[model samples]
Target: MAVSSYMTDAIKIDVWSDIACPWCYIGKRNLETGLAEVAGDADAPRVEVTYHSYELSPDTPVDFEGDQTEYLVQHKGISREQALEMAARVTDVARDAGLDYHFDNLKHTNTVKAHELVHFAKEKGLQGSMKERLLSAHFVEGRHVGRIDDLVELAVEIGLDADEAREALISEKYVEAVRADEEQARAYGINGVPFFVIDGKYGISGAQPPAAFSQIARQVWAEHQGEPAAV
Candidate 1:
């Protein structure tokens, strides 16, 4: 965690994550829970959340030749038993966050195009929807996120113009945006997924519990108001 910049007014949270990252999805759910907890407080700052790009497995093939277990066993250099154990551990964590993680059905593929679609959706004011859809498509429904047709169809499902999304992906329109986000992540010393930067001041890493994020939100709100720190 490193200090970036600041704003004493409304709160802004920028998240750097990837669609293929399970912990990122859990982190998202926990963040929403945190926001809900703070929403009841009249003194809480207005919060705006933005998602950025971070590819956890950039080297994964567009059409991955194996399943998640095999990929983990190969890419992570773990035994088959270890890969299954890791998946089970993450599955339980995701379940706690209300995510039905079907790792067996998950399609492990390159997420560059999916990240590009997120940027494209951001331009259309639907980045959040796109992010959720992409995550669920990969983790829950086992959709192939690397393919253009599947991504375009998912974009259309979220009310985005299919033609525009297709064209953007074809032309690599948002590749620079994705790269810029990665550069910012690197500069922030964020080497992990599900990193949250709050108000450009506080950095929270990993899929922490809702209480952890809520506590920070309360503290940030109190600080901005020049009041004693909230308990």
Candidate 2:
């Protein structure tokens, strides 16, 4: 990760992720676990988690057919066997994080629009729930985040105004914020989801165990006191 500017006080965590990515979902849970352990109250650390956009399959076709096996082999240059193996590996990882991943039913639609929806969610002060909903829609409920009507339906189910959500999706509003997030990821040399930057100075990458994130959160807290590093 590129060096983010400095900070002396509360941590500012900006997570770059794609809702379609299973690891991103687990990463969110793991990071939250860590954050909870490190804080005094349940919401301790008083985190302000801003979700940034990173499309895993930006050029993915608007509509795709068949199992993910064929999709991966054809689009990602991986063989069917390799793709299945990869899915199994990711499934195991998600399971370790206490999630049930059903890749078989997963409809891998282009997530650029979903990312756009998240940006709009941010403006609506519903980014957190919207992110959670989007992830569940894709990973658990098998909703098609790539389709405007489906996405609008899910957005409304999550308490967002349905009409507004549909309008924004169709009008492509708040796309610049999504693009800015992607650009920031590129500028920071981020190539994967679940990348976390805490306190603007302390950096962490990948969906590490919650203990790791808790340790870093405490460490950042210690830095504020100029005390020895917290274990």
The candidate scoring highest on TM-score is 1
Candidate 2 clashing pairs, residues 3+ apart or interchain: none
lDDT (CA) per prediction: 0.91, 0.82
Query: In terms of lDDT, which candidate is strongest?
Result: 1
- Candidate 1: deviation at residue 179, Å? 0.5
For model 2, how does the per-residue alpha-carbon lDDT over 1-231 read when each residue is reduced to its tens digit?
122222345667889899878889999988888887777644345457888899888877778787778877987798888999998998898888788888888888888889889888888899999999888888877778899998898888878998999899889887888898889888888988789878666567888898888877766666654667734
Clash count for each candidate, listed in order shown = 0, 0
Candidate 2 achieves a global lDDT of 0.82
Q: Report the C-alpha displacement of residue 210, candidate 2, in angstroms.
A: 1.1
In terms of TM-score, how similar is model 1 to the real structure? 0.95
